[model samples]
Target: MVKINILYASTEGNTTSFVTKLTDIAAENGDIVVARCIGEETDYANETAPFVAIVPTYLTGGTGTGPEVTEIFTNALGDYIAFGRNRQYLKGVIGSGNRNFNVQFNLTATRYAQRFNVPMLFAYELRGSKFDAEKAYHIIKPLFGE
Candidate 1:
């Protein structure tokens, strides 16, 4: 069976909700998914399985044109990957964001994918849509030769 680890953090729970959907799809497809929620107080571990990261775009303005765009909100998520050997095991990233944010939508996941030299596997708005989880599974399953 295909196995994937997911590392994520949620602020308003949108990121958590999206990751949950992915996990549900993986289960229905007979794949193994290990979902880990990382927080500032969580201990770090060197990942042994290929993993995906989920991050949400948090902007100061609803229009995303404000000057308050900052990385401070998801510092814990970034720190989790920055820990020993975690970066090496990252397979890809799936981003959730407000599309109303214009070019800033899903920017966090895009940045992580680029930094880690991995694909930005999937993206969707808050908590994803009815079919987004399934679509994401199809995209990622082939990467593991499933």
Candidate 2:
């Protein structure tokens, strides 16, 4: 079985709930999954397994055009990617944000994907739906050569 690691950040638990559902889906597909909250004591830089990231965008400077990522995510993931620690690993990115924010919606995930050269699998909204979970599963299934 392929091992998939999911690193995530959530301000109000929406992203956490979404990740939980995605984890269940990945497990059902027979992949060994490891889910870690951003601030948790996990060594993302040293991870050897392919992984996915789920981050949420928040309005910054009172403008939708400028969004800020959570410190927990930026601190951990920034160092991991900036230093090219996980550059050789296959990865995906998923972002969550409020649609009302318009231009800033899920932008954080987009940035992370570009920075890490990973695929942007899905940009889910607040409290991701069942469809998002299914999409996540489909994206990860093939990584195991299934």
Candidate 3:
């Protein structure tokens, strides 16, 4: 059984919803030993199993304020990802983005991915800002290679 840990840091629950579908897909295949969803607990120390971190990006328009998950995200990176010191782990990071706000978030995701050198996947919103659970699952289903 392949254990999959899905960690999320969501501002408006957009990413949270996306991660849920990913977990569902993992379960449907019956290959997942365990699929857990966590929020504000990205710290690697808190994670006992090999896991994947999925960060969702929300769209910000003029006079729009974005959600904040930096503290949780950075803490996890410091513990699990070897950015400065020398360390390595099997981890995957996937980021989801809104229509127009994706560019900035994509850059942020890439920076983090490059720093950690972990497998990274970025999913951009095809049409809308709010992600449909079922649609999201189908969109990312093929990416799991399952």
Candidate 4:
């Protein structure tokens, strides 16, 4: 069985939605996809099993006190990726941008993705509540090569 981890950190449910879509797609294809919040710890027997992280970008600069959501997952996955033997098991989604909805954020998420070397995908341009879920799916799907 092909197992995949879909981890996410979302404050306003935006990033959560994205991760949901990712998990759903992977599940539909017969992959054992696991989705969880950043704070939650999961047990995966396979160190090189595929993993994906989804983190949200906030307009404000404060990172939530707890492990910054994405960081927790990245740090966990990074260990496996750093070994240079698990390239196929790493992927990620960055929640940022949404111009039509007037949502703006610092985009620290992109940097996090870079740090882990996981493919990054934005939800939408900076805007206010005008997030297009379809667009987000399209953007994130490529990272999974869906």
- C-alpha TM-score for every candidate: 0.87, 0.79, 0.57, 0.50
RMSD for each model, in Å, please? 2.4, 3.0, 6.2, 6.7
Q: After superposing candidate 1, which stretches have Cα over 4 Å from the reference?
A: 60-68
| CA lDDT, candidate 1, residue 53 | 85
Top-TM-score candidate index = 1
Candidate 3 accuracy as lDDT = 0.48
Instruction: Evaluate model 4: give its TM-score.
Output: 0.50
Candidate 1, residues 41-120: lDDT per residue as tens digits? 88877777777788887655444434555654777888889888889888888888888777888887887787778999
After superposing all C-alphas onto the true structure, candidate 4 shows an RMSD in angstroms of: 6.7
Off by over 4 Å in 4: 40-48, 61-90, 100-106, 125-146
Output the worst ten-in-a-row residue range by lDDT, candidate 1: 59-68
Look at candidate 1 and give me any clashing residue pairs: none
Model 2, 112: alpha-carbon shift in Å?
0.8
- For model 2, the local distance difference test gives 0.71
Ranking of models by lDDT: 1, 2, 4, 3
Better-scoring candidate (lDDT), 3 or 4: 4
Give the range of the ten consecutive residues with the poorest summed lDDT in model 3.
63-72
